[model samples]
Target chain A: MATTLHVTLAGNPNVGKSTLFNSMVSGKSRISNHPGITAESVDGFRDRDKDRLLVTDLPGTYSLHLDLPEAKLCRQHLDQDVEFAMLIIVIDAMGLRRNFQLFSELTQLEIPMAAVVTKSHEAQLRGYQIDLELLEEQLGIPVIGAAERSDVRSLEIDDLIDGARIPAQIPAQGQSIEQWGTDLLAKVSKPVHPEQARRRRLRDDRLDRLLIHPILGLTLFLVAMTLLFGSVFWIAQYPMEWIDALFGKLGVWISSRMDEGALRGLLVDGVIGGVSGTLVFLPQIVTLFFLVSLLEETGYMARAAFVADRWLRPFGLPGQAFVPLLSSHACAIPGILCSRLIPDRRDRLATILVAPFLSCSARLPVYILLVGILFPDRPIAAGAAFIGCYLLGAVAAVGTAGLVRRTLLPGRSLPMVLELPPYRIPSVKEALRIAFDRGMSFLTNAGTVILLICIALWWLSNYPSTPAGAEVTALRESAAMQSDPIEANSLLERARSLELRESAQASYAGRLGRWVEPVLAPVGADWQLSVAVLASFAAREVFVSSLNVMVGVGQDLEDPTSMARIRGSKRDDGSALLPPASAAGLLVFYVLAMQCLPTLAVTRKETGGLRWALLQLTWMTAVAWILGTATRSVMMAMGFSG
Target chain B: MSDFPIEDPQFWIVTLLSISAVILLLWSRNSSKKRDQGGSCGGCKPK
Candidate 1:
């Protein structure tokens, strides 16, 4: 067996500790400008010779005191067997005083330490020269200066592995920690050759002044968001149409080749049609995340959070909740996980409870499809509607947060203290990689979970076929007797349509839909729409695919006709299925409903009680239903037509 | 006239296999979720 050695990275928040960790070993720890993003300890490993080196990256903190939860977590993890471990203390070259303060606290542990100073290039540009040799001599430990984007191979970190040992004497023994930190920093840091170009790097730049302005900043943020959502819709349109057309062609080709039977029905409708509904949305997912990644890389997200802090306090939330809320736009799971960054229990739970109200990537297809149906020819209107959906979700989340904080968990949120990371050029390649990874994960899910669902739904809607009703039999007879070819073909088409409709009404899924139709009636959802809604309850992304299956199962998926067929579908009474009122109501419901089972499970675990989860589910459902019904009623009263 | 596909032995065999596969997928997911929750499924498990 090889010998194992453990090394831990410790540092003040935003001191580039996470960047250093990424340099040392390959890890997927989310790198962001937000302080304490490393809410939990993440581990990475490397092997050299016959020995294994394990590195743990702990949450960034200013002090290692036991009272601070982040510090406590670090201590507990370190206490688990620190006898075999060494510490790497990362310091920001530009802010050595506070870094030394944390360093002073860590020396109390009496563990072997190595100091790594990062952002040397940035600091150098600003005229500060950090003397690593002086630091090494003063602290009696291994010390190294590293540049931004340091590669472990070039950093020669392995060269310092053996040199990591207890310092000759720790600082702060003779003086207070703060005073000692100041004195020690003065000795090691000196001003030299400052450049005018880099002077803006130290202080807030002109861009920061405008970005944090109350009016201009908020307006800019909204404009940026609108463009983002607009692009998510418009940019993805071409690929979505291509996927739709491709599936339609495949379905037609398979239908023409295969003999008419259950197998052909299953393959054409269930497999091809079902998967295509989801696959079509891949471009949107990739585009959305890619744009978000690009934006985050530029470090503007922290400033946005800073601007939002003032407005958030009135809603019973701190600016810290903004990161999690923004994360929820991609998925609720990570958003809930990120709530751990909130210090107070009430605030954290409040954030977790309402986080799902933000429309995630899963809801994008549903919004796009409905918006397309609603505003067919106008891209700008569709974009605005897309923004409206996101805005609705945000409004609902914050409103609920206020209500919950006032009633169920009453408490004021902590004051916001945020660090704004320096802006830099965004990396397109890295953004593409993140987007590609997310898109592939979505594709895998569609192939497995969605494929199974589509197959099962097809079976449910296909099985226990009943004999054709009298009307279809009469229509078929009339078709057989017609002499003119065109007239006879038309009669046959009607007969086939009637027969299929009868079959759908009798199938198991149809029966289930009928059972729930009365409850859905208030929202203007008939049995067909009810089936689609129920199918998507556990996995909201399945809404479009399942609706494709439910709305017109056997329609030849031949581009224009199939989509037109769906949009022109009629109810049992021959009225238009999705009138403006019903469509609007359905959108509202989807935005508010707690329709994800996995989210509920996560909520159950995170809150550590079934009661909270149940409350969340019940509260969200009731709010959705009531709001949905009201929207439909109000739209109808205001004279919106089918 | 030939019998329907559902009446054929091959169709039944395929159906059985597909059902088993789905069941296995669900079971594995449940087991893994339990593992993720520290080897005890919360709610019903004793402290």
Candidate 2:
């Protein structure tokens, strides 16, 4: 039997821990460039002849004593009774003093360990050098320099294994850990030349002056975000149309092949239509994550957070909240998860509570639909409205955070202290990996949730078979009697649409919509829009699909004729189904509402209590309702009735 | 009321599939919840 050695790789954030892990593990584990990516301990094993080495990658933390979640997780793992063969402490060569602080604290455990100094190339470029042999002798361990090198196999494994098996000695106890780290760095690491260090600092300071300027930074941020959202809307449209057409053809083929029965309906309407509705948003999700990953890798994200910090502090949020809030634009789950990066409990909670207000990709479908209806011929106005939705959500988030801080969780935000990493050209490979991982995760996880909801909604709007009215029956009969094939087909299409409308109205969803119609009437919603909104409670993206199905659009939302028909749809009182005011109201409502059940579930889990989740849901929904009604009222007052 | 068709194979298939999908969804959600809670630093066991 082969001997199995368990080795733990620990490091502070952004110390090339992921790079070393990826190189050592042979692409077996997921890797990302940003800090806090390793949220859990992942185990990977390598077998070299008779020796099998098991490696565990723990979450990055500056110290085990910090009150942060990552710090606690590291402590838990370190305190476990299971003996490890070795602990490889990866550190950035440029920041040896800061990184050694963590090493000094780890010495208290008396664990067998070795140090791997990474990024030596960058450090040496800045006129700094390290005496590796002296450091090894001083620390009484095997210290290796692995700069810009990811291949662990090239290193002497036997030396590390032998070092691990040696008895560890505790450091002298007189000096504090910080003092000990400072003393050790003085002995083994040569200092950079004062002039060179000052020059580098000057370069960073000059860039910071521009990047963090109140007005300049905010302007750049807005321009960058506008381009991002604009690209998502414009570039993703082609693929989205293709997907929509594919699903529509699939449904038609399925319906044509299978007889007009329950199975066919279930397959065509429930399964295919429901899944395609959510999947069409994949292009936007992928593009957003890829671009964001590129920014994070290039070290711009930290700077952006720093810029946002000064602006966000008045709203009771730390600068660190900026990353999570920006991430919420992709999906609120990851955004909530990333809130772990915020150290303060109150700050983290406040950020999490308001994150969902940021317009996520799920709301894109709904926005595009309403914006299309509201401004059919005006592309520039439609684009501005799209941008306006995002800004509205952001303003709402800031206001909500301010309110929360002043009342329920009143406190001053902890000052932001962050290490701004050196900027480099981001690796395209890493960005692609992150994009692929995020896109697949969304499809597999959120896709399942959306699929099930679509099925349930489809079933709700289809069951208890309503008998067609006399008018519809007569229309169908007259269509059958038409001599011209094209004219007859058009009549048949209208008859089918009428039948679908009647069946939907007679179904359970329609009845529920009617019951809730009065409450929504003030917000400019009739029963059709009300039904869609009610169905959207499971997920906001479902609003578009549900409305299409209920209105007999049949999944081809790209068809201008069908879009015009849906826009021209009427309520019982001959009012437009989605008038300008109602469209605007729904847009505002979707922007503010906490309509994602999964987000609520994640909130409950992340906050470790149902109280916070319930409070978030109630508060966001109330805000949405009030604002939605206000928008409707203001629009009506402005005499813009459809 | 219309007669309920217990003998129909299509009916049984739809019921079975629907029940399975619901179970799968619930199972996925439960597992996801567990992963989120268990992996969270806040929810980690106090040392």
Which candidate comes out best when scored by TM-score? 1
lDDT of 2 by residue, A101-214 (tens): 677677777778887877775576466778888887877778788655333435665576557523244346565657767787789878668587668768877877887788
Screening candidate 2 with a backbone cut-off below 3 angstroms (N, C-alpha, C), the clashing residue pairs are none
Top lDDT prediction, candidate number: 1
Interface RMSD of each: 9.1, 8.0
lDDT (Cα, tens digit) per residue for candidate 1, span A231-327: 8778888887787788778888988899876677777777777788788888888898899888977878888887888777899986679877776
The DockQ-derived docking category for candidate 1 is incorrect
| lDDT score, candidate 2, position A630 | 95
Taken over the whole model, the C-alpha lDDT of each candidate is 0.75, 0.71
The TM-scores that each candidate's chain B achieves against the reference are 0.61, 0.63
Residue-by-residue lDDT tens digits, candidate 2, B1-47: 22224565665565566667667767776775554432311111100
Q: Score the docking of each candidate (DockQ).
A: 0.11, 0.17
- Stretches of candidate 1 exceeding 4 Å from the true structure: A1-7, A14-28, A43-55, A82-94, A110-169, A187-205, A552-570, A573-577, B1-5, B8-14, B17-21, B24-28, B31-47
